[model samples]
Target: MSEETFQRYSAYYDLLYRDKDYETEADSVARALRAANPNTHSVLEFGSGTGRHGRLLAEHGFDVFGIERSQTMVTTARSFTDDSAVGRESGIFDCVQGDIQTTTLNRPFHAVLALFHVVSYQTTDADVDRTFANAARHLSADGIFFFDVWHGPAVLHERPAVREKRVEDATTLLTRLAEPRLDVDRHTVTVRYSITAQSKIDNQITEFQEEHCMRYFFPEEITSFARKTGFNVERSEEFLTAQPPSDRTWGVAYLLRKRT
Candidate 1:
């Protein structure tokens, strides 16, 4: 992954996704974890972003640690924690800046999570393999690994299209345009993002561009990764809804249990 990925984007990340239902998603994750192992207590999250999910998971009564690739995101998460009363009181959530493929916390957790299509961000085989291995390393025996990814069937059937979103805060108006190019053979979609931000106070405008490549996965391929990493495939379902994945399902969640 590029070092510059999400560097500038992290500043506006929360604003772009402010409407997302983090609570519901976290609830689903908690249910999945408990169903896999009722004793689950500690959680290590990869691609933790600004720690929204981590905070919710912590509130669910689990000790949550997060690893994010962007230093800006890590700082933002920590700042939020320091400012929030609940965060200071509970103190069950913390995060650091690190890559999922290379960073080793040297401690095991009862569960590991890579939500919000974080695993799909690994666009290459080696990257995916290393990420899975890292997850395995951070998990206790029979620990659960749960993640969501773009489903191959859905990606292929529906196809990606250009889209735009506009959002604003008191200080700034932000517009983002996304154009996608699908590589059928590679099973990847490269999304080019163009963002324009205008200051509400001074009307000053700034623009930036970034490209992200995401991989969609098949069930068999995910099972293959689990098998190679000493895990047993527990289940797969549509994210949040827990419905069986089909061509209509865009995001699918998978549960894997690390073998003893």
Candidate 2:
């Protein structure tokens, strides 16, 4: 994985995910937060790429602080925040580039968020452990942690397949092909993405390759890590819905609270 993944795609990120409904996701996250602690107004988001979800949360009245590892992503997120009414104030939507696994801001928030498989992006045991520790450190006394990741049972049942996506606009045309290589022994999948972008007017083309290594997780694995990281698992359910996870569930969201 060249660290340049987000750097390469930050500009067209919103266009790439034009169909994504961040408002619904943020609402779901808010529901979970309210269920755990009704008065969550501040949030710290891990791996907050492009700050899409963070902005939505901020619009919904949460003071959002996002941590991203990519400088380009941070810049893009900051630009978006600067342009939005909900984020015109610096305190409403602030983003920083830092290692999510071990960053300590000397502060705690009403909640901690690892949306969009930020947890699965930590493919190593050490990475996962440190990320959970970071979340624990950033959470208030009664704060809750919310995260979603690829479900191990679903991954095992329906193995990953090669996929391609294309999004085009008046300015440019973008294509992405994802080829997955699964390591069952390590319980990880490395997806090699070939991205091609072409300018509409000049007919100029640019191509780049990036490998994203992600790990799928089981409920037990989450619980075990939670125990070691001073967190308590409150709920594990299929993401984007309240249904309990099953073998067919592709993604699972876990809600956790700091161990008191």
Candidate 3:
């Protein structure tokens, strides 16, 4: 993916998902961490866009490290952490720019996370395998892994719909439209975003487009991958809740543990 893919989205990312409850999501993560390992003290997050989750995790007393591929996102995430009191003295959240499939830190983490469809971004077999390998390598023997991805069955059953969203602030008015194209054979969906922004202050308008390719996943496939990578599937369920994954659940979270 081109670095500029998120260049424009990074500017309006906060406004676009202004309603997203990062704190709630972080709470869910914390609960999972506790259930998996009561002594959880460190976390490694991939595709930590905007770093909100990492920031919240840090606030909850976990030392958090994030890896993002987008330079613009890395810059913004760093600014958020660097400007915080925890960042200045506690050294809680530290974000770096790197591809999750290949990037590895010198030390291991107690918990590894790939939230918000970060795993789906791996559009090929090699990409998927390499990502799993990295996850296993970076995790301690007792480490747990958490990831959320689009459910293939649900996506095929419900199908994605066209969406339009408009958000505004004192200085800018923004409109976004999404057009989705599905490749049933490849189990991939390409969502094209058309964004229009008008600055109320200067009356200037800017428009841009971005296309994101997401690969939907199935449970059996995950089980196979986990076994191949020397890990066991501990649990799989709907994200942010205890509901079991079914044909109706579009997003599924999988909890994994290293095999003893």
Candidate 4:
């Protein structure tokens, strides 16, 4: 709901997600949304960081509106579609700045999505419920809502306590250190990131720290919550396929339809 950490990552978000197959993921979700209804035309994308998925949706001929909490991310997202000279024009991309838990739009959408583990950012049940309620308020009757979250079994089994990686480009060297803390009873994991970037200009190492807390709900718990929030639970799958989640699965995607 806040902006400082997201703002700091805005400059490097694309670089970090460059390796991720966002286009493939968008295609998969779009196919699922379309199969749910032939008339699906407009989509609302929450936590649409840098408009990566939004652009893909536009390319698929769907009207896409993105909501993000960070002003810096919204600015970068706007540039993706607004800069005609840059030749990255997807006129269907529109971005707004607001938190998913409390934002409202003028009209309802045919479909809604929150990809890239955005749902995990909600560390409390109240936050999750508020987000689902807000999304339901903006969804047309029979519209589908799709989202993904970190898999509880995977986190509990793997217990990835620490990680370190570095990315170097022509102008910058970015180093990242991650420390994970697990709370078994809460089914929550808090990751602390210590990031250091050395600018090519003077090779100065600038340091920044960010803490992200993610709640890992069981598959049944999530589906039950969706049903309680007035959604007809459609399907929950491991990753991109319709399969039971396992201890090694990193995340699971859920598809829910607004009760008609």
Best by lDDT: 1
Candidate 4 Cα outliers beyond 4 Å, as residue runs:
1-3, 83-91
TM-score of each: 0.97, 0.95, 0.95, 0.93
The TM-score measured for candidate 4 stands at 0.93
Q: Could you give candidate 4's per-residue lDDT for residues 1-260 as a string of tens digits?
A: 33465667667777655678987888898898889888998999999989988888887778889899888889888987754223343438788998999998989999989998898888788899988988899999898899999988888877767989788778888888989988888878888888888999898888888877778878877877797788977887886776788888888898889997
- Residues 165-246 of candidate 1 have per-residue lDDT tens digits of 9999999899999999999999999999999999999999989998888999999999998899888989999998889999
- Model 4 has a clash total of 0
**Mind giving the per-residue lDDT tens digits that candidate 3 earns over 52-129?**
888888877788899999888888888887544344434388889999988879998898899889999888878888
How far does residue 13 in candidate 3 sit from its true spot (Å)?
1.1
lDDT of 2: 0.86
TM-score for candidate 3? 0.95
- Say which prediction, candidate 2 or candidate 4, comes out ahead on TM-score: 2
lDDT (CA) for every model shown? 0.91, 0.86, 0.87, 0.83
In model 2, the runs with Cα more than 4 Å from the true position are 85-91
Candidate with maximal TM-score: 1
Candidate 2 on 30-115: residue-level lDDT in tens?
77877788888889999999888888777777788999998888988898776454444423677899989877898889899999
